[model samples]
Target chain A: MEKRYDIVEIKENVLADNDRVAGKIREELRRSNTCFINLMASPGAGKTSLLIKTIEALKDKYSIGVMEADADGDVDAKTISALGVRTLQIHTGGLCHMDADMTFRGLKELGFEDLDLIFLENVGNLVCPAEFDVGAALQVMILSVPEGDDKPLKYPLMFKVSDCMIVNKIDAEAVFDFDYEACVERARALNPEIRPFRLSALKGENVDEWIRYLDGFIREWRK
Target chain B: MHEMGIVLHIAKTLNETAEEEKITKIGSVTLQVGEVSGIITDLFVDCWNYFKVRNEILKDSELKLETLPAVTFCGDCEKTYPTVKYGRECPYCGSYETWLLTGNECIIKEIEAETL
Candidate 1:
């Protein structure tokens, strides 16, 4: 006769464990008054360019650190380090995304105590990064003009998870058949509260507005 | 790879649960995966099978996946419909203002285990 095993109710999201770790990281960051932003987007979506612009714009006011999470590369870290900010490159060892545990390790290495703002430039992927929460108080994602406006429909979860959306490469909008309004509308449909910023990171267009908003957000979060 | 990541997380959570509940061996795990959760069941099971060998507590454990139906609610009509059948647009009202009400979930509903 087969014995029935005791069924222990474990009604928890699979990501709950990760979320716990993420919550801990967020609390630690809170004590230090550090604003953590998980910046995500598809590869070549100008995450690095925007980071440089944001850092340059805010570097004078706040001490900034960046934990660049890439599957493999120090190129972005080197570029950001050129601006003289504390930039740490996190190699995911071929993983598609960085989980909360990996994020905690990065923060420990980067030392969040002295920093006012830390940007985890998450792996350049749309799908995987959205699935995992890295304990950021704010989540920012980019959608380049070249990537098309239909991206929001294809990757709804990415837009849904993101708190802010940056429509980068607007300088190339003339060449590309990308409609900014349509893109924002699609993303807004998924996430009614998702704030969208249309800018060209390469051309330094409208980046100031984004930075100002971020500054205000950091101020609010720290308060 | 995404399935592998999820499995890893599941393993992590199960281990924690095992520790907390004092479970020596897990007989089976029942998961409530939604249709639009974006998780491929076959890949998830394959990953689970591949992962169980390393985790002693999960040795020979059966993975039971119960799919939760994906449902979308139309903002215009205020009626729910099958998400897989109708998609984002409402069939009855022909409105684009439809949002997912259910699905897009991966929850560990229950776990059968041997306690000490």
Candidate 2:
């Protein structure tokens, strides 16, 4: 006879294990006063370009470190390394996203504590990266004008998990039919506290504002 | 897809457990895939099939996936509702101050196996 299944209310999260591990990494970062950002988006959303601009703008003040988690692309990593910043490439091999364990490994490789700001450029995926926490202080995601406003509705988790949203490629807004207001409304509806920035990474438009905000945020986080 | 990586993790964990227990055949592997977990269901199944083709223990093992609906608890309303449909906000109170009660899961909940 089967044992009488006493319905025990087991309130356990599936990502709880990962979250516990992630919390450890977060504590490690906190102890060292290191600020880390997880940058996520769909492929070709100009995440690397934004990183390049941010590094160039703040390289003199803060020691920037980049951990590029890509399934195939190294072109971005190469570009970031060219800027004379400490950069590491994490080839996810065939995986679509980077987990906390992988980030921990990369952290060891980079000797992460020396960094003032560590940006983990997650694989350019709108979906998978939202599922895992890589122990970042903040999660920033990009939505290019070319991808359309409907992305906010379809991929809500990315926006929900992200602390900030970068609506990139405003320079190409004239050519695209993307509704800026609708995207902002939907994103705000999902996450009211999300910081939104409109910029063109390639054209270097409004990037200084982003860098300024980031600098201020880092200052606050440090304090 | 990344489901393959998840499958590999499951397989490795199951093998470790089986070796400790000295089991031969397996029955079912139950997984909890959250509604907003970001893992594709079809791709997980496809990866399981491909994995079974190479493994003997899981050759005929069944894959059971339980879809966990995303639910959250609102601090204002003091109730839990599906976050998959309406996220962060309480459906009744429309408050953004809420904690994610469930969802965002990708776990191997239970594994059944047999001894020789």
Candidate 3:
């Protein structure tokens, strides 16, 4: 007797399924007149700081929400919730990124009925977060000044996929030897339409420009 | 890394698939990974090896990965080029109207199982 094995041909795309869910979420957000922004960055890239500033600037005008995702802990969530807006912390348990399904569940928990803007503070990792769409109208990538300028070349996909790149911690430019122009040039080489913003979330430097851009974007999206 | 999460999902999917198909043991799993899928193949296999021992159905399973080249379609020039090289801009016509055609996919292509 010969041992036989059965080969099962299951041609299923894992990310495509996630994209489908993300597309559905996008449609739902559009119907509700909500602008969802997926924020990505390396650890300690001032993502929370930027969110705090953005929330402070826009919360009065728009109904805002924040979905803080981390491998573990709700410290960021606590910070966002102190502002008195809807906030939810999603512990990925150990995952480095949040997919569309996870974001959809987070949206369900936060209740998107009255929210005009939702910022998904994705887990602090550049590579993984860039891979998942998470149903955001805009994908924003933050690069801190201390992270060096060659990051765009190293992590091309992250820069390529991002709609806007925020060069945070510009206040530390005097201390760190970061080539701002070179970084912007590299990002432009990868993605020609990438809008690069040089700002410092901690010093409140150039944040108003970002706020203005977001205001325009949200207004256009709502229209 | 997120590869651990992906491996866990793959294992869960395999387990569910095996259960529905009445498979007692999975011999191997063939995954088609794209060049730009953001998944490191070596790390993914290592994660699978680490995870397989915990699951009886996948205890002795072998993991195989095939690389799918990344390609981008240029809408302006209507040409396809390797994404890893040309990126968002079309190399042929220097147009920014380009989108990814393939590669950025983590797909399960085949699964081999044994019936008890």
- Chain A TM-scores of each predicted structure, in the order given, are 0.95, 0.94, 0.96
Candidate 1's TM-score: 0.94
What is the C-alpha lDDT profile of model 2 across A51-97, one tens digit per residue?
98898888898888999988876888899999999999999997989
Superposition TM-score, candidate 2 onto the true structure: 0.82
What are the per-residue Cα lDDT tens digits for candidate 2 across B1-116? 56776676667667766677766766777788888777889988999999986887778788889998888999997999888788777898988888787787777777667765
The residue pairs that clash in candidate 1, if any, are none
Interface RMSD of each: 1.2, 6.0, 1.9
How many backbone overlaps does candidate 3 show?
0
lDDT: worst 10-residue window of model 3 chain A: A10-19
Best by lDDT, which number?
A: 1
Candidate 3 differs from the real structure by a C-alpha RMSD in angstroms, to one decimal, of: 3.7
lDDT per residue (tens digit) for residues A41-149 in model 1: 9999999999999999999999999999998979999999999999899999988899999999999999899999999999999999999989999999999999999
DockQ of each: 0.79, 0.23, 0.57
Q: Write the per-residue lDDT of candidate 1 for residues B12-86, one digit (tens) a residue.
A: 999999999999999999999999999989888998999998899998699999999999998898999999998
Candidate 3 chain B least-lDDT 10 residues? B4-13
Judged by whole-model lDDT over C-alpha atoms, candidate 1 comes out at 0.94
Sort order, TM-score high to low: 1, 3, 2
The lDDT-based order of candidates, best leading, equals 1, 3, 2
